[model samples]
Target: MRYGEATVTVVDPRSYMTYQPFLPEAAAGSISPRHVVVPLRRVLPKAEVLTGRVTTIDQDRKVATIAPLVGEAYELPFDYLVIAMGAVSRTFPIPGLAEQGIGMKGIEEAIGLRNHVLEQLDKADSTNDEEVRRKALTFVFVGGGFAGAETIGEVEDMARDAAKYYTNVSREDMRFILVDAADKILPEVGPKLGAYGKEHLESRGVEVYLSTSMDSCVDGHVVLKNGLEVDSSTIVWTAGVKPNPVLSRFGLPLGPRGHVDTQATLQVQGTDYIWAAGDNAQVPDVAARKAGVENAWCPPNAQHALRQARVLGDNVISGMRGFPQKEYAHANKGAVAGLGLHKGVAMIVMGKMKIKLKGRLAWYMHRSYHGFAMPTWNRKIRVFADWTLAVFLKREVVSLGAIETPREEFYEAAKPAPKVAQSAEAQLPPTRAKSEEKAKAS
Candidate 1:
């Protein structure tokens, strides 16, 4: 943008981009919800930020169809297009999963999950019915990846804290189940750390099911392939994610797994004017290639996305200025995940040495790493403050489920009162009745 060679425009369905790494903490009420997102307009004041979704793109005509949140759809023309549209949750046609399963993708879903979990606890505490209490107390999370594991871990911790306030529902009464198709969880960190994470959760009384798949979740009656069936009120689906389906509508060349195929330069294959990155692009890992591996691609993580964005931005500028484009090449920096309050796992690679950390130190590492990685000083400060407060203060156990229907009270209050009509007999005075009686007597 500083080059003044081109007018930049960023089109997205949301006005803000959520930092997904902090979602677990956000869900667990460790951080304020608003601090998790960075407003595009605030960050990029010069770039035109369109609060709408791109429905289709006709590269032949260099025009994309954008449908706003409201009203009719319109076409947007561009000289050069950057497809950083990101990815969506990958789901299958599983019976009852769509109707009953909850997702943990967006900010709204994170907040909703927090509220829903607390609401379930409230239901369990207030109810005497065995079935209702059991269902409310049972929480199932499919996918033992970072999103699934971290969420269940944090929410379970929050629920434990909340149980102290409840006379009826105790921590032992609640059942937290985590199911994964893979043999190990937290594959981002090595197998040993992953095994430890699973063990840690199990020690906390969380049921860890490995190499098992959920057959169905019809009406929240979860049936696993391993012959385990549970009627749960909350079923969180964080299984996995694929490239956004909208990418198919753009008439762009896609990979076998449905991601935009991009060269090392981050530009869409067979097209010079179009560029793609993030979870939607199958970016080549130059480090892997140099390490004598063939066709190795970068994993879909915040670390890769952050680095890719910088290189993509620089390449865009270079393209506009007719300068040589540099390929994105960065070695893996390992992975870190927080499992509730003081429990976490971190694998940091420094040169050839791999450092494995767990417990409180790993938890601090997780916070410090994310706090620095978060975009904008304003957001960074707020996130750091949340961590600081968490050290001094206990986790907030209250749930604002009413926030979803905040206007309900106002709506009820604004309703007009009922009108009552007076009958003619009631309107007559006692004197009129006596006069009528005297006339009759006369």
Candidate 2:
């Protein structure tokens, strides 16, 4: 934000800002989902973005409403508010998971999970129906943290390099699976680097399971609360995240899970012209309560929301120059993930010393620390030119699932224009054309 004093604006519904750890290398096509987002009018050129969707928030009339993205619902009028709406997809009504899961947060769910895992490897390579080719090569990931173990280790390494231009879909006819109720997986990269990222995604075949849980999948069948059963026509759902429940009508003071309860100078606690930080705010982890820890907070990550967004924009410009605010603190600096091309897992931490890395030097320090934490340099030179054109191109592996039905072939070429072939007395039916005109007038 090229901080031009005051007058900011910034509503949202994606004017762009994703950069979500490069959404598993943009679902393993190796980073290109439009360089993983960041536009907001080219990084807030003096703010005022407004894509829209605030839908109500009075706070005793500081006003808010907004809705736009294409029409009515207005209002706005702020003085300082800023909650940072983030988080959703916590899911678990688990019975076909709201019509079959598949979520990765955004960037249109990582380009619809990489065109639905390469259209389930092109329906398991032109299906001959071995149970629809094992339910289109079964995928099924379900959160093991670090977004379901770096998205089933970069979609099982992009379906094992797209089963080498599939003939009948090789890579041992793909499966992947993953599921987790948390017995351990990336546990924030600790426990021996989360058991070396669960033995490097179980040495690439993937299956994992850990403490399991998934009692239903419905139509695509799966079952699992330990009883196991499968079917899987893809499934995904990186299982975690909550906060953005539109902040329950925004009146503020949220906490015990809904978030926005700030204070550690990110304001909001009793409102000081309002303010908040990432993952929808719940602040107060001031260096884990000065290390005594006990009930500490600040963990909805992104490295403590990038240092609570530079101490909530220098405490909203020092509460508009009345000054004195700056509290937010930080203490951990380690955890990289990558798991695909070259594979990964890292840890760095400084003060108490840590350093643990694994494989391809933790995948080149997870792509040079998320390509210098991508966000301008024009999306870090388009994510380092999509990792230098994925080093000599090739891995595109196709499947743009028709970009999710773009007007479905123009609604099947705007059908209904083929009804002009009805001659023969319009297919004869008016009393057989008056009994063939009285047998052609006898």
Candidate 3:
């Protein structure tokens, strides 16, 4: 029945779907990196999984051009289309941003961030240069959304715990600055919870800057619009995300902001068989509209994306057959964010009642909710195990930045090619060479 009866092909450069909610914890080393992603092949065995990119789609001919990892590109034909390319980090043309800023988009970035933060502590503790030490200990995070707030919080917690292992490095020796153009951070949790989050971070000695933005990060020098200048070695960019630009090439009706326009039913506005969801689709909030709210749209969060996927899939099956399509409508359950260990903010909506929580209880709720929400039982168990193990074990704070360029050390130690050696006769004088040969023969 469902998608099994019809042929399905999934094209993506990555073979797994990354559970992005756990990325902050993964970067903080609270969860294993391997457990934060679900393998696509294992999850979708019925579909033909291709580890490549769908470069273009020909809706008229019903063909898609795919560029594989290690081969020439090819065209794939399909009947019903599902556009779920997702989104990429939104960035700007800020000076030196591309060269110096670190992102928090994927698992690889999380791993790199962990290593980099720990390595900064190591460098600060060992260096005699005060300038270098100060720069090493300073961290700047831009954006105050879930990604920025949670990441800085978790990373700060990690660095604080990691400081104990070093002789000279301590919490006071480090500086963490958070910047957001918005008036409050974590706006999804409501203004009260957002204020609580800001105060919580500040009480823990983090510098919170609201209504401020970074002007430039050129040459490791951070210049803020409010006239704050500092040299920071670690600059984290988690501003926001925009829909993948590739969607523009898909020949579909798109919204003003470049998202594919779709009805509440999750089907593309004009197309009958094609469907799009997740961060790439501009889906109207039907549930909100019925509540008398106007121009409401689903936020680009995992909470809405997961629900939309289910609706889109059902709509696809209904289109394949002659059944009617159901419109997707669900109110937001709530929002929970983990700041550091034993610290967070949450707002839970049960039917018509809304409950607000903060501090240790909120942190627990954050972990519990995200742990259960992680895709697959295997990952769920592994994430819980990682947390349980942390209770009895000390935090691992070693920097293995070599993992990025794994073969660099080998290249440095490798010997050069052997030089050609001349024969003894060739080295001898012209007259003595033949004479010495004749004597040796005799």
Candidate 4:
């Protein structure tokens, strides 16, 4: 019998889902936000996709406790389970981070942030107070990794282009600061490429502070550990991510970083009926093996996650019907990053040869790779069309800040009831008094 026929369900918390590689471009306005996200139901048509947070997993009974989006908690039973819940954004116990900073993780956050940035520019342009304008113009981004770096690059590029339309706001008056505890940015790429990316961003007037960390962002006045202080309205935090803590309740084997331990075949260790992949599993990377080393694991990235999912799907099917499973062995293809519109850095490994490219070539390579890697043809065409049209037409500068309250304007206009004119019969004054006066005159 098929797994779906024998009771199998996949639980994902968020409603807005996607492959996630196109997030940077979506934030940069290169691709529409709608094109970047794919519905979970469409992709996993066979499996039941439950929209809720998995609070607990009981491996002993092969059951998972899920809290539904609107209903009460319920138990789901399965013969075989796939744990691909993914990671959560990591945040420190900073004083005011929760109050002031925003994160880039899901599609909603990306779209909200894009609108928020443009709205800030509009607010700055209309305000006459210098203090308020400076605060509105200043943007602080914490973390120097891919999320932080790419996000800041795209937002800055869009903001710079947008400033031309604003009468008061100029690119020079606006401030963009990037803060990271590490000495370098984009460490996923090699050191040379990382250095190139930093220099490229700096040349574009982005103030990058290395070996520094954010101390506090209380009341929107950012304080850095490097003794630097800046008052800004916008703060983004994208330092890193930690595995979901709910896995610990499953009573299964877990690795040092709290990720589920899995074998090379993508099956969870000590369990034949369960499988895990993506950012939630620590599957041994046979390709990264050294001559003397016993086992090595691959890092979490879209490249690895996509391949791992395929292997996991096949292995699950094979196991359900009594067949031999295959081991996953794949080498890293290299890394590419877009700095802004026409600038990027890449390091590609083609067999034994390693090649590096920068500037416009790298930017084109980044777009081409991601364009083909996007989930479906429907999305790929939409993304390409958005970019193709962008070349000739100016970027859309309007911010629909009231997108959430789309009906508010109409509701306000319809609030008061219309006034009606009274008929002459209803308006006749004191008929009884007039009749009494006429009787006295008679």
Candidate 5:
């Protein structure tokens, strides 16, 4: 209510906004699935929330089309539009990827992955066939960024714990492979920390493949360009993300890379009424610009997105009234990545002094930063509680994979039996047909 006269509406496909940084913990069962998300309605009580996909935006008419989950499409008009729809996972034309590969983008995927990994263990333990067991034990991950590295790290940790309960399966039997075309992993933490992360995974028996590419994974047979082939039941793809494709549908000026073009003030270029931010907007790196660097753009990460959202919101309010809009400008504080429980890396920049940290201390730092940064007090308390409980309890490794297809058993049991042909007389009540025939004869 800063302006007191303006109304805001938030339209998104999901009712809640997912905090993606904790996806690895969720997948590893270190955190509850529900704790990683903030319900938009709960957080944005002043704004109107529309749970649906925005198919098209007609800026000329100031109306956009919304396709809801269980209703006909409708048009919504607005005086100003903010395109912060964010980005989606970028994938190439690799065969069988869409069919076989699991992603680590949302809460559902994290839960599904946890269940899937545990289910694979169950299968390996129960199976008698050597090939089946081998396939079930093999896990392949594409991409070595924060999503890929932390995911494999946390998941491997969880799997090792689960193996203690399995009779036939052990951590030795499970193969974890992380493949990336880049020469190093965790590039955000600089070279030293990235190499440390790689060595750490290697020490844990994870096969880290650098300067390699997956050729194809047709029918679960992963073929790499480096002449390595493996049959893995679990294939995770976390390569990277591109701007949301829906941006093209909106008649707005987009950058060469498909992000909506926006000025330093977070206002869409060439238009005063439109504003955009986050991954979908090509925001200028204000810190870089001040250092006399040319062609600098903000990196698409949680840190930037969170800050940009606040700045964008303020700019929107200022733009509505006749107030000067503040330009978004902030120097990089640092970067942090958690690798499973007590392992992590961090870089903190304070003026000219640069501090690098690794191992358990860095892990604690990572948790503290993100715990407070998590949107609402409700989520912060829940996340903190999960971390506090982890000190005394082990990670839960149970799988509910059946949740994906819950109605399968019901469908099988409730299936209609084969129809049998019955004579017309057999359809009649007992003796009714005979009485009717006798009456006809009389």
Candidate 6:
């Protein structure tokens, strides 16, 4: 049943290779977006990595109907399937969200956010209109998790630096807000570190709203559940993510949160061939079981995902060749997050010891760890080059919003004419008529 190198199809809707740990750095201009993402094709050269959304699956026939980016949907048969489709940004049905706020999920969003922030600064500087300037200078970020906290921090740092170059705009005029429903931020790094992060952000003039949720962001007018109202132009939504709902359509058993149910060996429950990993699978935490927990599942993070992927790959080979499969188990390997340049927090769990770091040292550790963890040598060099060049050259602040619609301007400039040109057929030549009559007589 096994094909050569095995036809392993990793179904991720987004084709970009996301080294998510560097997203903050990318947003902050510390690293380039090009450096943060690797092409999935280059990495998974052997496997048939299909970049498309899975509309539905027939588990009995082992065929998945996929809708690719272009063209029509088609059915692909597979002997073994791996579900690593990952999670999508989660947003509640808040009024005006669709009209305004941007979510930080993929590279496009990150780059768009960076450009929008810089463009806001430009707008503030170019216009003497006080109302427009005020609106342009205000930035609001919802959710206090790693994405929200880090994105706002990096953006604030960039904006502050950029203000120095602008004659009219000053850092004092710009307002930044961080809103979260939870009382604390960065829960993965523990409570004490979360408190430290909040303080660090507040020290930089960011208004922190705890135990508050956004009611609406209609027409750039923000209404919070705490009865506060503010009119701002930029709103960022980083309010966590749920598993891709496509799993439910497959007719497979899904967990409470819509993740596929998988055994400790990373194989789908009751199936011999199918395997799941990454953010999409609810893999049992055997370590938690040994520690007397009733039922615990692996948390969805890159640290766990990378390890699970290796185990899943090995398990596929083992299952096909009649070798023993190993159970996937790993203890939490701490967490590190950069608040801004030279400011970060870290908690390392080594054996029985739990070591924590903060400030510049933690920042260094954050960069160092992620630098080594980025996919390949080519990406590692590009990231380092970005850092090296950043020391001498300023971060590119121009926003190519037009990149999405490059042809719009050209099409408008070259409008089509309504009338057609006159041809020789419109004037029946006398010589041609005579020649046709002579031929008919002959």
Ranking of models by lDDT:
3, 5, 1, 6, 4, 2
Model 4's TM-score against the true structure = 0.90
Candidate closer to the true structure by TM-score (higher is better), 1 or 6: 1
**Pairs clashing within candidate 6:** none
lDDT, residue 80, model 6:
78
Q: After superposition, how far is residue 263 of candidate 3 from its true place, in Å?
A: 0.4
Per-candidate TM-scores read 0.94, 0.38, 0.96, 0.90, 0.94, 0.91
Q: Candidate 6's C-alpha lDDT? A: 0.88
Q: Candidate 5's residue-wise lDDT over 45-146, tens digit each?
A: 888999898999887899999999988999999998899888889899999999999998889999999999999999999999999999999999999999
Q: On residues 1-442, what C-alpha lDDT tens digit does candidate 2 reach at each position?
A: 2455568888987788887888877887887888788788887787789898998889888989899878898898988888888788898787997788888888788788888878888877786779988887888888888888887888788878878887888888787889889898888878998988898788778888888889889898989888889998878888789899879787788988898888888888887889888888888877878889876887787878877888888888888878898898888888888778887889999888989988899989988987887766888988888789889987787878887778889888887786677798768999999999999999
Please identify model 4 stretches exceeding 4 Å from their true place. 1-8, 291-295, 407-442
lDDT of 3: 0.93
Flag the better candidate by TM-score, 2 or 4: 4
Q: Would you list the C-alpha lDDT of every candidate in the order shown?
A: 0.91, 0.84, 0.93, 0.86, 0.92, 0.88
Top-scoring candidate (TM-score): 3
Model 6 poorest 10 in a row by lDDT: 1-10
Where is the poorest 10-residue window by lDDT in model 4? 1-10
Off by over 4 Å in 5: 2-4, 420-442
The clash count for each model shown is 0, 0, 0, 0, 0, 0
lDDT of 6 by residue, 1-442 (tens): 3446556677667776888777777777788888889888888787677788889888889898989988999998888777888888888999999889898878878888888888898889899899999999999999999889988888899898888889999999999999999999999999999999999999999999999999999999999999989889999999998998878888877898899999999988888888899998999998878878879999988889999989988898899888988999988889999898788999999977889899999988887888888999999999988878987898766667777688999998898966877665555588887787798999
Residues 23-111 of candidate 1: C-alpha lDDT, one tens digit per residue: 99899999999999999999998888888988888888999898999999999899889998788888889999888888888999999
lDDT (Cα, tens digit) per residue for candidate 3, span 376-421: 9998999999999999998788788999999988987895867888
Give me the overall lDDT of model 4: 0.86
Error of 1 at 371 (Å): 0.7
Residue 54 deviation, candidate 3, in Å? 1.0
